[model samples]
Structures are given as C-alpha cells and as structure tokens.
Target: MAARPDKLVIAISSRALFNLGESHRVFEEQGLQAFSRYQIERENDVLEKGDAFPLVEKLLKINELLGGEPRVEVILLSRNSADTGLRVFNSIEYYGLDITRAAFCNGESPYRYIGPFGCNLFLSADGVDVRRALDQGVAAATLVAGDSRKRRDDVLRFAFDGDAVIFSDEAERIYKREGLVAFTKAERASAQKPLGGGPFKGFLEALQKLQAEFELDSCPIRTALVTARSAPAHERVIRTLRAWDIRVDESVFLGGLPKGEFLRAFGADVFFDDQPAQCASAAEHVATGHVPHGIANVDA
Candidate 1:
C-alpha cells in the first residue's frame, strides 16, 4: 500500500454544512422575513442574531467524525457576500471541536472550483453543482456526519459500479449505441480478454498503494464493486481488476437490479457511478457520487 497522506482536505459548500432542517429553522427563528421567489433569501442577515449556530455545530461534528486536531481542513463557501466567519468561529469554539483551520469565501454564487489540491471530498448543498463538478472530474463528496471518534475511519468502505467505473464504458456504449445483440456478442468474445481503461484507473492505483502502505491485513480502506452486469460479462471485470493488481474486498454482479439494497448492506462510505438514476437512489441510502464517463460529452 502506498503511504497514507498525513491529512485529508475537504472543501464543503455552505449549504452542505448545515442540515436542511437546521438551515431552514435558523432562517425562521431569526425572523428575517425577507423572501425571494417564495424562499428565504435574507437568512444571512440573521447571522448577527445567532442564526449561524446550526451551521457551526454541523461543522464541528464533521471535524470530530473525521478525527480531531489537524486531521481535516474545512473550507466553507457561502453565497452571502457578508462575512460570517466570526459567527462560525464562535460556534466552533462553543461546540469544542478541534478544527485545525477554517476559511470562508463569500459571493452571490455558490459555485466554485475547489480541486487540484487532492481533496478526498468536495461537498455542496446544490446537487446540480455537485453533478456538474463530477462531470467536470471532481468526484467524491464528503458525507455529513456527527462528530464522534467511533465513526472515524470505521470500516472505510468504498463502493463502485463495474462497468465504466473499473472497466471501460465501451461495452456499455456499444450496448447503448448498437443494442444488446452486439454488446453480448462482444462480451462473449472478450471473455478471456480484459476491458480497456476506466475513469478510476489512477484512483485504483492510489488505493493499491494505500493498501500496501497500510498493510492489507489491517487496512482501513476496503473496496467493493456492485454492478448490474452478470455472468459472462463478469469475467472481463475480474480480469481487468487482476491485470491492474488492485484488490477489491467485495464484488457483486447484481445483473440489472437496482443497487440500493446492496449499497445499503455494504455500508459504504461513498459510492461512485456514471448513472444518475443509480446515484439518485444510492445517495438516499449512502454517500453516493457520480463519475462522468469520459467517452460521453462531459460538457453536455
């Protein structure tokens, strides 16, 4: 396994930091009645009256679960132009969370690029922006959790789909483009052969390095592949993984079934795929992410 990085970097969108209910409650409790398009737009004004407490609590809890004291960096991006760091800081102090550092970026737009720094997770309250970022190559958003040492790296399981995730999406594209007949014929012929490259090729290599660095026996990172392609298509998946020398703790070929049940049973920390329907359901059950297939029009 490769050496584990000393710290994990996380850039969190402001809305993602606060739970939906908490944010809404904060707006109402402050009595900041200004509304825009029938939604509260002046909630930021209430921060001076202590409406940012919930957001702070949520941040502290996230820091706790991620391991306290220099383990994580929380970068908050807000849509409000006013500075809310002082209130956010006071809330962190009140919660007694050991946050090594924190930063806030204020603007009317919540969308921002936060990558190229090797952040393990990039979270946003706006699902649309999250999707766009994933399509643009930023995968793995952090899951919101309460501050607790028990959940820190507790069975850090990662789940992924077989097609497109580990193997190239070529076969799936053929199926989609030319229909099932050609796809099946191609799969049968490629049985002993391996699929082409995948979106997670580098990530897989990193995980292998991580596994070796931590020692596979007591490794904190575990991986699973849950795909809908079964039987004949399974061989290529196995061969591809073997050729890459990457170890997957669990692999399930569900053969065209919804992956929600399996993902829930696996208790994955994050699951990645290229399909929205799959991600939409998986996100309801776990910390799910979408990895855009390069073959497709990423900009589209």
Candidate 2:
C-alpha cells in the first residue's frame, strides 16, 4: 500500500455518527443482550443523523473535489461488538456513506487504537474516551446532540473555542485556580507573548492547508474563534494565531454572553469548546463538540 501520511483521518463512534439514543437507553435500562436484539431487529432501518453528521458529510464531500481519491478518510470506532455493529454498517450503506473501515471493540476503550489509526480527530459521545484520547495527545471531542442549522454546501463553517482548544490551557488553568482579576491581569501582561498550542492546533493547521487550495473569496472552509474572553484577554489569542500564521475568518469575543444565537447567525456546521456548559448552549443552535481538555475537565 502507498503511504498516506498527509491524509486527514477522522475516527467516529457509532453513537456520535448516528442517532442511537433509544438503543443506548435500552442498553442502559435492560442489558447488552436486549440492546443487541433491538439493533438486530432494526438492522434494516436507516438511522437518523447524529450531532456530527453534517460535519462528517461535508468532510466526505471534500474528497469529491479531488477526483474521489479520498484526501479524507472516516473510520468507525465504536464500543459495540462486531455482530452488534452490523446495524451501523447497514445504516452507513443505506445512507451511501463512503466508509469501509471500522473497529468494534465490544465495550473496551477504542481510544487506544487512535494512534494506530493516525486519526487527525476523534469524535464520540463518550466523555471518558474523549478525555483519554486528549491525554494521549490525540485531538478528540465529545459530540453533544444538537439541532443542526441550515448548511451552505458551498461553504463549510467551523467555530472553535480559544483556550484549551486552539490555544493552550495555561490561561484557563490560571482562571480556574485564581479569580477573574488574576486571569485578566495575566493575559494582559502576556499579551505580546504567543500562547502555547493546544490539542486542536494540528487539525487547524491541516484545515489551513486545505483552505489554501482555494482563493479567499471562494474558500470552502471558513473558520471562526468564538470565545468568552473579551478585550485584553483577546490580545493573547490574536497574537498567538499571528505567531502561528493561522487564518481565522471570523472571531467573536462574547465576554460571557450566551453563544447559541451567535453560532446560529454564523451558520456553523459544527462548533467546539472545552466547557460542558458552553457546549450545551451551542448545541441548542448548532452541532457542538465538547473538547474535553485543560483544567475544565479535571475530575474532583
């Protein structure tokens, strides 16, 4: 096989890739046997779209522009057994999704295989798996179920959090430990210094490379920085991106304002944040991914 070191590989869980809420509830309430039977019975039924559906669909479409040689690859990484995964594969076929690779760990953590898969990003509904993936230096996000906004096929919009996502969690740790005043002072003091890179930095860099394939006016990918930090805190983020030579088409400094309406107006295909509350809020308006990183995710 030829080398594909540059391919953007994305591994997704069955639950995050499809709408399996009822089946999941059955598994939790009854037992694995009952859940397996339910899935087997509904094997022919096409599953509904999940939180990451739009994003995945768009990513797959990016291959079409390259004569279908597949610059992007999507893999199924789920906790279900191979037999139980038949329903997932059936749905994938029903939807005509171009996915041919999968790993059904049968309840074991699939994150351990992320490195072997060379996944640029991992998306799942399981928080524990996401946190573990981040800890292992892989970019992963917990997919929060949400209502998808109207998507523009010609343009794909992505909104990301500032701290603990695109930038390092240093500022976030200070904020979590100290009060707002200390965090603000620290950001202002380090305004000239570039912030450290976080988990999603490589993914953003890859997207930037993809963006370069088209003109600015005609670029298919549009990225935004939608963060809660305002004014002085924003300087560090700007300088950080400048130092890294990354392009952000839009930026919203909310200053603690709710992000749902803003994300709706941006018509984002997906949004990512480190905080659970922010993800829940964004989920109300658009598909949201919870980046489980930094002090915000530390267990008590």
Q: Which candidate's lDDT is highest?
A: 2
User: Which residue pairs collide in model 2, if any?
Assistant: none
Give the per-residue lDDT digits (tens) of candidate 2, residues 188-218: 9999999999999988887887778767787
Global lDDT of each model?
Answer: 0.57, 0.87
Q: Which regions of candidate 1 deviate over 4 angstroms?
A: 1-8, 20-82, 85-103, 108-113, 131-136, 140-153, 191-197, 292-300
For candidate 1, lDDT tens digit of each residue in 5-30? 65444556545544344544554565
TM-score, predicted candidate 2 vs. hidden true structure: 0.94
Task: Report the C-alpha displacement of residue 94, candidate 1, in angstroms.
Answer: 5.5
